[model samples]
Target chain A: MLSYLINGISLGSVYAIIALGYTMVYGIAKMLNFAHGDVIMIGGYMAFCSSSYLGWPPIICVLFSIVVCTVLGIIIEKLAYKPLRAASSLAVLITAIGVSYFLQNAALLIWSSNPKAFPNLINLPSLQIGGTQISAVALITIAACIVIMIVLTLFTNKTKMGKAMRAVSEDKGAAQLMGINVNGTISLTFAIGSGLAAIAGVLLCTAYPTLMPTTGAMPGIKAFTAAVFGGIGSIPGAMIGGILLGIIEIFAKAYISTQLSDAIVFAVLIIVLIVKPTGLLGKKIAEKV
Target chain B: MSSILSVTDLNVHYGSIHALKGITFEVKEGEIVTLIGANGAGKSTTLNTISGLLKPTSGKVELLGESLMGCPAHKIVEKGMALCPEGRRVFSQLSVRENLEMGAYTRPSSEIEDSLSMVYEQFPRLKERSKQTAGTLSGGEQQMLAMGRALMSKPSLMMLDEPSMGLAPILVEQIFDIIKSLNKAGTTILLVEQNAQMALSIANRAYVLETGKIVISGTGEELLCDEAVRKAYLGG
Candidate 1:
């Protein structure tokens, strides 16, 4: 049971990281970059190429993936999303879907459909705690998630650029009036979010040990689900939502059935939405007269 | 004093609707200039166009002899003009202090502490509620926060739109007093208000906008005593 709990937390950490990307973009840009998951897939491939082909160290491989995805995210935003700024939400969402497909097909062409074995980036020995053996990756994943959350919270609260982001998220026109470069801020958000996606991709593939063109799809959907479950736009909410989702999925697989776990996880989301429509931490936007 | 901001033959359109049609006005350094009009008279539209939030269909806007046409809103702010928008559009989720910090975004980081202290001194109520979320503040406090936020940029020419809207009569007087004091301290003021009496009382010069056109312009005292102005707007 303890082993399963640790494994669950490890998986949840990846979702938490990815969900941060989704929640942040939704919060600031007010658009869901559904292609976000594909960015993760691209990040994983970048890491794989660096580690296996170039024989680079693990840290360098991780940094390379982050840089590539950050640049890719900015390019995608400039090419695909920027033009749709004034368009309707429905139009933006459709464009996002188009971008997602474009990325998937692009990856298929470059990397082929064959799955690659993901190298274990963290080679630390397993730790034994309370009569249970926990893998180093699991421990690292949890620690990394906590650190990312703290760093992000501080960045938003303590830095000028972060405060500008929050201001833009609240009111674009007011933020602009304050001399904030609204476009630049949005681009930065995409950059940060995609960079985080790279970390999530590396962690995810390290745990599952598989890399393929479609590898990011399931996890992306689950992380997005976790984002919504936590009250879509709230940062702390994403962490809580992601961890809860991981535990629920693990327990459902253990006590129920592995085949039913995904179904049960989604069922739980539906119930949460019905009970609290805004997710766990989402504040109900009150309209002031 | 030289003209701090000059708008000549300015026109604006909201799609098919002509919002501001060939209106011209100039605000001099160290003077309170008010634009007074009834609802849907393009008062807010005029301010928005000048601030670069809305593009003008035609006309020239100059700030300190520099043409402001085609400048983005943020760039315009860097050029020393700030607009305290209508509806007190404070960042509701942000703390009052954070909202103030956003106002100083155009200024140097070294000057932020000084600007913050200045704004806090101007609106002591805001200082008291600095840590509170802006959304929780009452309407009057929100108005003060908006004004204080604009002041954080340390703008040379500050434009305020409907600052007294929805405020209690006593709060309206208090707000006007702050505006008066701010102008006295050397900030040029361009004010838009439906409260014609209060607006003109503090305005050195005033323009009356009607259906997107400026129908009357004069010294505040002259307009206040004019039979036509008293009959139409001052409730003769």
Candidate 2:
């Protein structure tokens, strides 16, 4: 039971990281980059290529994936999303879906459809706590998630650029009036979000040990689900939502059936949405007269 | 004093609607110029166009003798023009201090602390509620926050749109007093207001707009006592 809890937390940490991307993009751009998951897939492939083909060290491979994903994210925003800034939300969402498919097919062409074995990036021995054992990857994933959350919170609260992001998220025209470069801020948001996706991708693949063109699809959907479940645009909400989702999925698999776990997880989301329409932390924006 | 801002025969359209049509005005340094008009008279539209929030279809806007035409809103701000938009559009979720901090985004980090203290001094109420979220502030407090936020940029010319809107009569007086003091301290002000009597009272020069056209222009005292102005806007 203890081992299952640890596993649950580790998995949740990855979802939390990915959900940060989703929540942030939604908050600032007011658009869902459904291609966010595909960015994770691309990050995983980038890491796999660096580690296996170039025989790079693990840290270098991780940094390479982050850089690639960051640049790719900016490119995607510039090429695919920037033009649709004034379009209807429905249009942007469809375009995001198209981008997702485009990234997937592009990966298929470059890396083929075969699943590659993901090398264990963290080789530390498992730690035994009390009567239960926790793998080093699980421990590292949890620690990494905590650090990322702290850093992000500080960045948003303490830094000028981060405050500008929050301002842009609240009111674009007002932010521009304050001399904030709205387009530049949006691009930075995409860069940061996609960079985090790389970290999530590496951690996810390390845990599951498989890399494929379609590897990011399921986890992407789950992380998005976690984002919504936590109250879409709130940062702390994503962490809580992601961790809760991880524990639920693990427990559902352990006590119930593995085949029913995904279904049960989604069912829980539906119930949460019905009970609290804005998720847990989402503030209901009341329009002032 | 030399003109800090000049608008020449500016024309603007909102899709098919001609919102601002050939409007011209000038605001000299250290002057309080008020544009007064009824609702939908293009008062806000003119301000919006001058601030680069809306593009002009024709003519020119120059700040300190440089053409501001085609300059983006953010760039216009860097050139020493700041607009306190209608509706007190403060970042609702952000703290009052954070909202003020955003106002100085174009400034250097070294200047931020000084700017912040200056704004805090101007709006002591904002300083008191500095840690509170802007959404929770009273309407009058929000108005002060918006003014303080604009001041954070240390703008040479401050443009305010409907600053007294939705405020209590007492609060309106306080806001006008602040505007007066700000202008007295050497900031050029371009004010837009529907409160014709109060606006003209403090303005060095005033323009009366009607249906996107400037129908009258004069000294504030002259307009204040003019029979036509009193009959039309001052509730004769």
Candidate 3:
């Protein structure tokens, strides 16, 4: 039972990381970035390529993946999203779906449809805690997520750029009037979100040990589900929702049935939605009269 | 005195609606210029255009003898102009201090603390609630926060749109006092208001806008005593 909880938390942390990207893009840009998951797949491939082809060290590969994903995220924003800033939400939504398909197909063309076995670069030994043998990777994953969450909170609450982001999210016109560059802020948001997605990609591949063009699809959907579960635009809400969703998935698989686990995970979401339409932390926005 | 802001033959369109039709105005250095008009008379549209929120179809806007065409709203603010927009759109989720911090977004990091202290000194009530979220503030307090946030930018020309809207009479009088004091302390102000009587009382010069055209332009005292102005706007 304890092992299940720990494993669930580690898996959930990966989901939490990806969910942050979705929630943040939604918050500032007011557009659901459906292509966010594809960025994760790209990041994983970048890391795999660096390790297998470039013969780079794991730390360097991680850094390389993060940088590549950040630039890719920014490019995606500039090319696919920026032009549609003034367009209808439905148009942007379709465009986001288009971007997702574009990235997935691009990956298939480059890496092919074959799944690559990911090399275990980090060689830390497992540790026994409370009669349960826990992998060092699992421990590191949990610790990294907590640290990242703290850093993100401080960045948003303390830094000028972060405050400008919040201001832009609240009121774009008012933010521009206050001398904040809205386009720049939105770009930074995508960069940060994609960078985190890169980290999540590496962590997820370490645990699962496989890489493919479609690797991020299932996790991406789950992370998005977590974001919605926690209330879409709230950062802390994403964290909570991701972890909770992970635990529920793990328990449902272990206790109920593996085949029915996905169904059970979604059932919780339906219940939460039925109980509170806005998720847990979402505040209803009153339209200005 | 030289003109600080000049708008000549400005025309704007919201889709097919002609919001501002060839309106012209000027604000001399260190003076309070008020544009008083009825609802839908292009008062807010004029301010929005000057602040770079809306682009005019055919017109010229110059600040300190420099053309303002094609300047983004943020760049306009960086050039030392600030607008406290209509309806007190404060960052309700942010704390009062955070809202003020956002106001100084273009300033150097080193100067932020100084500006924050100055803002707190100006609105001590805001200082008392610096940690409180702006959404919980009262209507009058939100107005003060909006003004205080604009002041943090250290703008040479501060444009205000309907600062007294939805406030109690006493609160409105207090807000006007703050506006008067701000102008006295060397801030050029361009005010747009439906409350013509109070706006005229504090303005150095006034322009009466009617259906996207300037119907009357005069010194504040002259406009206050003008018979037509009184019957049309002053509720006499």
Candidate 4:
């Protein structure tokens, strides 16, 4: 039971971190930002390239990966979303899918399809807690996730630029008139969210130790589920949702067949949606232009 | 006073609908100007175009003697024209205080507190509900918050659209009174309203629009007493 709890917490922490990026972007841009998951994959590859291939230090590799992934996010925004700002949401959605496919295929070409290992990063010593073996890396992932979430929450609620994002999310025109550079705010949002995803990617690589082109898809879908499971646009909602999802998955794996893990997680989501379509923390909004 | 905002031969379209057709007008500083028209008279479109939400198909919009053509919405804002958009588009999830703080996002970060205090003084109810989410506010309170948020940006000229819309009769009076006071406090205002009587009462001058065309322009009292305006707008 304790082992299951530890594993659940470790996995959920990653989802919580990645889910926040999804939730924050969705809250402000009202776009699903499907490219978010792919950015994580890119981050993993960047780390692999920097640390193992180039013999760089681990911390420097992680930092470099974050910066590289942030730049990729900005470029994606400029190339795909910005030009199509006035286009229909469907157009942007298709564009995002294209971006995802393009990046995955490109990674396949560049990094090869085979899994690459980060042996040093993966060897986190196991610690016994409550008669259960929990590795230091898992605890580290959870702590890092908590710290990032706190920083992001503070930035959004207490800072000037964050106010601009909330304002634009509320009403774009009014925000523009208030002298906020709307485009700049959007770019900043992409940067922050993608940056968080990169950090998650590095941490995820530490736990799983292997990377390939398609690794981000499962985590992406899972984080997205976590985001919607909480509340699509609510920050705290995503956090709680992520942790809940982790616990459920762990329990399902422990108590039932491992094959039913995905099924159980999604079944819970469907039940929640049927009970409250808006998710646990999501507040229903009144209609307006 | 010299023209602070000048629109000449302005034409706007949403896919060839021709919302504003060759419209022309000007606003001077330190004056309360009203633009009154019936529904679909292009009043809101005019304001939207000037605020850079929509680009005029062809024409000129100048602010402070500078051409405002081919500018994005934020650039127009940086030029010191803040819009309190129609329907009071407040940041619903944020507190009233946060909404107002967002208004000064382009200004120095240190200046937000002072701006919030100023807006709070203008609408004490807003100050009272400073911590309340804007979505929970009544329509009147929302309007106050919207206007307050615009003021937070410290724009030299403020454009207000339908400030009296959907408010109770008493709240309508309070909104107009606040508009008058805001103008008195040194914010130049360009108001668009369907309620010509209330608007003219507070306006220094007024323009009458009908289907994208300017039908009349005069001092507020002069237009208020006009027989045609009285029958069509003021309801005799």
- Model 1: which residue pairs collide? none
lDDT of each: 0.94, 0.94, 0.93, 0.87
RMSD of each: 1.2, 1.2, 1.5, 1.8
lDDT of 3 by residue, A189-259 (tens): 99999999999999999999888888888899899999999999899988999999889999998999999
Q: Which one wins by lDDT: 1 or 4? A: 1
What's each prediction's TM-score?
0.98, 0.98, 0.97, 0.96
- Candidate with more favorable, higher TM-score: 1 or 3: 1
lDDT of 2 at A283: 85
Estimate candidate 1's alpha-carbon lDDT, on a 0 to 1 scale. 0.94
Better of 1 and 2 by DockQ: 2
The 10-residue segment with the lowest total lDDT in model 2 chain A: A280-289
Question: Model 2: residues >4 Å from true position, as ranges?
Answer: A285-289
Candidate 2 shows a clash count of 0
lDDT of 4 by residue, A1-289 (tens): 8878878988898988889989988877788888788899999998888887798888888899999988888899998899988889899889888998999999999989999985455556788887788888888888887898788788888878877788877777777777778788888888988998899898888888889998888888899999999998888898988888988998999999799999999999999999999999988876333
DockQ-better candidate, 2 vs 3 = 2
